[model samples]
Target: MRPGPSHLDTARAEIIVAEAGHRAAVDYVSRFGKWDARASVRQRPGRRLSGHRDELATPFPPELAPVAAHALVAGRGPDAVREVLTHSLYQYLHFTTELEELAVIPVVAKISRNRSGLDLPEAMRADAFKIYTDEAWHAQFSYDLVRQVERASGIAVRLPELPSFVERLDAVRASLDPAVRGLEALMFSIVSETLISSILADIPHDSRLPKAVRELVRDHAEDEGRHHAYFRQVLHAFWPALSARERRAVGPLLPQVVLAFLEPDYRAIGTALSAAGLAPDEVAQVMAESLPRRRVVDEVAGSAGSAVRYFTEVGALDDPATAEAFEASGLLLGAAR
Candidate 1:
């Protein structure tokens, strides 16, 4: 049956209305904290930790070497401002999606307990809760940061009006055959969590950003360590269940996913450099030099360090495949070293 244009528009309007309501609820909960104000209160001030500046001593590899150079050569001013805006827009959308998804974790955790024998350890459970809490904080932080940047620079950074991540998530959720659940866990852990940690960690400590932005990144990095651990544990638990066919299917997908996620940062950087008034050649140089170093910082600050520690603790590094994959992916490749 052919629907009238008005009818289709009405349906889309309804969807938009429903999504807006969901987003409002998410924003309210994440920004203002839980309905019970007492529960949402911060007990202690979040500590600001400095990133390892010495880590830059390591030389960037061929793969990431260019980005670092590009950033260094990029001019400052409108181009740099635009770069920041572009990057912030991407982050705003990414974190907002995470904030919305993590908001539902409590419900998912409850369901896992009731329907599946997915018994999470007490520590792991706490970590999961902390992740949700941290994600909410990150959402608020990103939004506020964007707004601040817009006000300060007069660059209008656009936020996503719709939840585009839901399509990807819904696809994963629909394929919830228990046999594939571990793959799903790994998908979120490695692809989403690990990638994000690396990028956040890469953000220069001395970047001309506000103090609040730096602090938020630092706090989020600490929490991501725990989140990475939880996902690793889930992956370890599900390891034996994966058949050869499944492993083969999953192996190739990881790089693709990782590359897709990282691509946005590159685009943002380019836009920012251009907007900041850097010549194309200069932008290219800074990206070549700085981006790789940033990748190294991200790996160390987030999951790669924890994953290596986990491997050592559990004696899993003995597995040739695991060790090889880690090295090939540049997980253990420290900056230039």
Candidate 2:
């Protein structure tokens, strides 16, 4: 997912067409997709590590604090760093695989097969099929990389069987009225795709990470940039198709949807820290100090700024209840307009 200028151009073109009226833009995967030339699975790139040292040079970016911050305070050297990095990798792999398999594919399969209630264009539906391929490749490559990294680092992976986000998303879905319950996957899929993650944006550029790791992230980010554009168009089509009642029911769930993706998994982080040899009390202190309420709010708000604005553009925020929910969630606090 090493996004370059071309990816940006593709995204911009998609946005222009979507705004003009949800027409198909120049197809990224079809016209300019890197699947054949660059997808990790197709390309089958291998991990290139020095044979002398069995430990990873730096599995995760040290500059990425909270996790890295905890690593430093633990003072356990490479072992601590390795644990944090591997855990981070596991979390990422879990997100990539689970989201595709559970949350995204089900909704996308409906869209691709023209079974989703929305009246999407044939071109949009075709694009949905391509997204299915891309997401599958993403999950495949992510899994392959996890095994490669584990073998390389010799660190046992520690990950929750299900990521916290999935659990949280299920809880949100269960809490919804049955009338609008059907919209949970659709809405959350849109939010997940549209929300800009800093991890994807920043990781490829970080020089300290392993080449394979960086390449994998770069590939993922590049694809997600297109996905970000594509889903915005999906929303453009989807919002107009919803009835007022459905809109009212679903709009207030926007903040929770954003949070379901962006909020820090403190439990996962704590587990990672503890695995890194931080005493339980030390882990607690690090968790409390590194990721305070304000910082988490700020990061989530920042990442979610574009998605919120897109919802606003589509009139999801026009409803008083939806607007009030966003304000109460504080997702809009200091977020870019």
Which whole-number lDDT from 0 to 100 does residue 192 have in model 2?
94
lDDT of each: 0.43, 0.74
Q: Which residue segments of model 1 deviate by more than 4 Å?
A: 1-41, 44-130, 158-182, 190-209, 251-264, 277-305, 308-328, 332-337
Prediction RMSDs, each to the true structure: 14.1, 6.9
lDDT of 2 by residue, 1-337 (tens): 0101212332332222222233323333333244467544456454444444643666776655466656355477766766786787777777788888888888889889967755554566777877787788888778777887777777777777877888889888888888767867788899999888888888888877777777788878877777788788778756765667778888888898889888887778788887887889888888888888888888899899989988988888899999999999888863555
Each model's backbone clash number: 33, 5
lDDT of 1 by residue, 197-231 (tens): 44356542635444545555565566555455445
Please provide the root mean square deviation of candidate 1 (C-alpha atoms, Å): 14.1
Worst 10 residues of 1 by lDDT: 22-31
How well does candidate 1 match the true structure in TM-score terms? 0.52
